[model samples]
Target: MASDTASLRPMPAPERALARKRRYRRRLRSRIILSFVIFGFVLTALIASTAVYLRNRVEDQVISAALTKNNNVFAEGFYRNPDAIGVPFEKIQGRQFSTSKLDRVPDAWRALANGVHELTEQDPVTGNERVYRLAVRKDPDYWFFLAYDIAEERESQERLNRALIGSVGIFTLLSALIGWWSAARVMSPVSELARRLQASGDSTQPEPLAPHFPEDEVGQLASALDDYAARLTEVVQRDREFNADVSHELRTPLAVVKGAVELLLSRPDLDEKTRARLLRIQRAEQQCTDLISALLLLSRNERGHGATDVQRVAEQLLDAHRTQLGGKPLALRLEGSRELVVDAPESAVNVALGNLIGNAVKYTTQGEVIVRLLDGAVEVIDSGPGLSAEDAARLFERGYRGTHAEHSLGGGIGLSIVRRLCALYGWRVRVVPGEERGVVATLTFSAGNGTL
Candidate 1:
């Protein structure tokens, strides 16, 4: 029983990237719904439009032809029997014509004599209406009035229209509903498969997609994603092995250096020269220690970069700076009440700040360098040799030795670190001349907190 149950559950793959999982649910739902809605709307509109056109066409043709035939018959009757004017209704004309057989048939009814009635006429009995402009002048001697029976034409047209509308309306409604269902079926399973595959990252159990997938583009896409996920599992397992190796090689040496330095300090008979040399060695060892530690922190933050909350992290970095700079009070000024937070890792801010502050202290001979945090920003302003626009623009690139850096204890690698970390975290950096002849380096984060 246990073995069968284990086999039924889907297996998870080795390694899915973190971001892909975060957005999978929302993305897949939107895709499936949108596909069905778009196709259904288009089909419904087209069907309705065609139906309307066909109904109108049938109605127009029936009414128009009936009016013409009635007028010809009326003209023939009027000319043949002028004496029958008194008996016009006694023998109604065109009663047996093709269009309508309603009421008594076409007659020239005099309506109060002000306006000449047109060739078309309406029946007093059936309320059926017909309209036409005069086709020719009337011959008074023969009492010939070319008029037509329009009731039957109108009634026939209305019947055909009712039939057409009933049929087309029903068809459009049924087709639209059925098409929407088909579209949903085509997309829903594929959407679900994508959602399931998202959690397939580097576990021993791989995600099992449904065996029955739709045979369409969506199915092909899901299969491709599965293959890609399998490959990614292998890659992540390898990275784990590599990370272990990097950690061992890097940490072991750093530990040995500190141990050796402590041992040297323990010796009691050392003169000032030897003591000074050992101190220098210690500082060099300290540099290496900082590097390895920074690298490890960077790796971790990039893996699980903080949530959307940013103000707290910025405050933390600022508090550390305050402690280091002695009793000089660091005032906080955001455009508003809160600190700016962007989607980024803590190491990104640390690496950028490390370069900025270290460079400021090394170059500035006078006042304190103010670090400002606002919406979308952290800036370091120092009273040092201000840089040219040319120097500022390209300063942060690796191996780019600036003119100002040449005059200080700088190799241009510090700002390069700042640039790279900023890029990784989606922040931007710019350097400008300060209020005095000094340099002000500012980092603008990707988002703002409470700011104007």
Candidate 2:
């Protein structure tokens, strides 16, 4: 609650500057804390010294203004001199003070001579009980002994101490307020920088806000951030333009491929051999169309700005492939959860999966092709001659061919299409030996889930 109130308060320039200082200089927090500690120590020393000085000075003034007479009141038969009782002031050894010449000089005489005394129950000189203010009145030639007791000096000292202590309290409070205000001022700019950096993550590139202290470390940081943001923007812009170019170019070829495939399939051939050969050509043409579509999907995925109906697309591709591979003594096992969602265009998933399945049907002379979808992974297992260890290592690379399937059609771009599409979506691809005497290639969309 207090923090909100402070934030809402119209921030002064000093407070904002201080906040910036603190943000960039996390060390500044510790420094300010240490400064306050040192300040407290110094203030304590100053206040305590002031209190002591006031106490001693007031005591001196009170003692010097008092009147002293004879010591005449002792129930134990101590005779009163000019004072109530003649008591001598105890002089410290090796200290230059009054010497006793005039006998039984009073407290008033000591006060006038700028001398100090203590009134104690015990006599300082002889340990006998007495109330004493024994001092000397020093003339240019001689010193006179004085003895008397006064209570006003001790009381005055107490009052002075009280006044000094109050002043110290007020001073400490003011200092803390000023310190807190200064700290808040320095932290403001630092917080702004933090916010901008956080927002930068979402954007392709975000320029840093202008810093108040551009000449200092904070300024250097802001300048560096702006440079980084500009670089990032350039990279993103370049990638976007590249994707756009690829998409536009691939669409025309893909349309021609589809038209050719449909034209061939619709033809009424003359003989069985010619029909079979035409079917082969039609199938090849369809593969070319699929490749072009996959390329377009890769382009779209690279741009990474769309709401893709991945599940619907994947199912549609599976239906088409199921029709294409009809009467081939092979079964396809597709597995997915009800919500098999993804992060790229529907074309991306279809192109990627179609390449894998098409390759499977091409190589697999017999047995089952399993399209397993667990989590976000799509694995195609075919009962073809499995990829050699050497080939599997570089299977997804463009134009790469395996030892067993060296004569495979479509220029070995099936897996490469898969790879490029996965790149667009930032998916992981793994090609390993299938459980049986076959091969398995997997496109894992673990990262692409949230990419949309």
Candidate 3:
């Protein structure tokens, strides 16, 4: 029951969604647009970052230079006159501590070396955080320090940062537009070529694509497609001619053989053995003719409509296989509905039923092969060694044979042909292990293709 349910289930929704996503990502135009967007974002980000870094670096250098020069002048003036007042400035403060009064220096400033250092301190008047650059010069006789407040510089830097960020966003938007336009311009000719190729595919003769475009990459692709189409058309023409010729030529000899067998069977007093041989010959000729017709239809990849009686075809196939059983202790039986009919050619139905019945008969050496006909389906169940996982997975692949087929005298294409016929006629075929110890092969016909 599990196997039967799985065999009939459609593709899951998640799998279909994943397949769609993969196809979407594979489009050349989408990839091109994505590339442009990424390039724009990265280039703008790098430039904005560099601008911020350079602005901060130059501002620090200018402030440090001014502080160092002022501190040096204040130290020289203090050494020249011990009672000189502190260096004058609005946002800049100069301090000097003699060796005797070194403890008067602020603890935060006393530990500084001779270089510009940035420090954050609480404002004495506003009770707010203040940021300043400290320049220090230490000597054995005195220690000199200069502090420069950079609150205005901080505000300016913040504004510049915001402006740069907005520029990055604007540039990114412009880049996206450029990418969209470029993708459209680049993919236009290719899309047109594809359209023309698709239109050509529906007709008997395809229109030339190279004549419509300039000689560039797209044009070269169009020329190559034209060449491939021409070669393919020639191959298809030859194949059609060959199938027609074979059908015509082989039917003549098959008709002669069929006529001779009928004539021989009509005679009375013939021995049982001789009559049986003639009957076998007749069945063989009929099989050959049916195979030729089926192969011709397959070669043309066309379906011929007919109201084929499903039960009748199954019985004929079972009878043919039963005769070839020879000394094998096997039974061939038919069960289920008798009125189920399929809207497909008798030849195709015969070949499909013949292959399934043939496989069952071939594998089951001493057990029964039952053909069960349903309303819109038929099953060939054999009491033989059951299907394996590997066999069930790849049984319909051309040239693939089952483990049980090792000793069989066939090229392993019978089931492949059945698969193709099923697809062509809107039918479905699946094989699975039976309930106990055999294989159940089911061929189901869809509505409108099969009827009661």
Which predicted model would earn the best TM-score? 3
After superposition on all CA atoms, what RMSD does each candidate show versus the true structure? 12.9, 14.0, 3.3
Tell me the TM-score of each prediction against the true structure: 0.55, 0.41, 0.91
Best-to-worst order by TM-score is 3, 1, 2
Candidate 2 lDDT, 324-344, residue by residue in tens: 675778776676654556766
> Top model by lDDT, which number?
3
What is the Cα-based lDDT of residue 164 in candidate 1?
Answer: 60
lDDT of the structure predicted as candidate 3: 0.86
Instruction: List, residue by residue over 30-71, the lDDT tens digit for candidate 3.
Output: 888888889999999999999999988888788888888888
lDDT of 1 at 50: 78
Worst 10 residues of 3 by lDDT: 1-10
Ranking by lDDT: 3, 2, 1
Q: Which stretches of candidate 1 lie over 4 Å from their true place?
A: 1-143, 149-176, 202-219, 267-274, 300-353, 362-381, 385-452
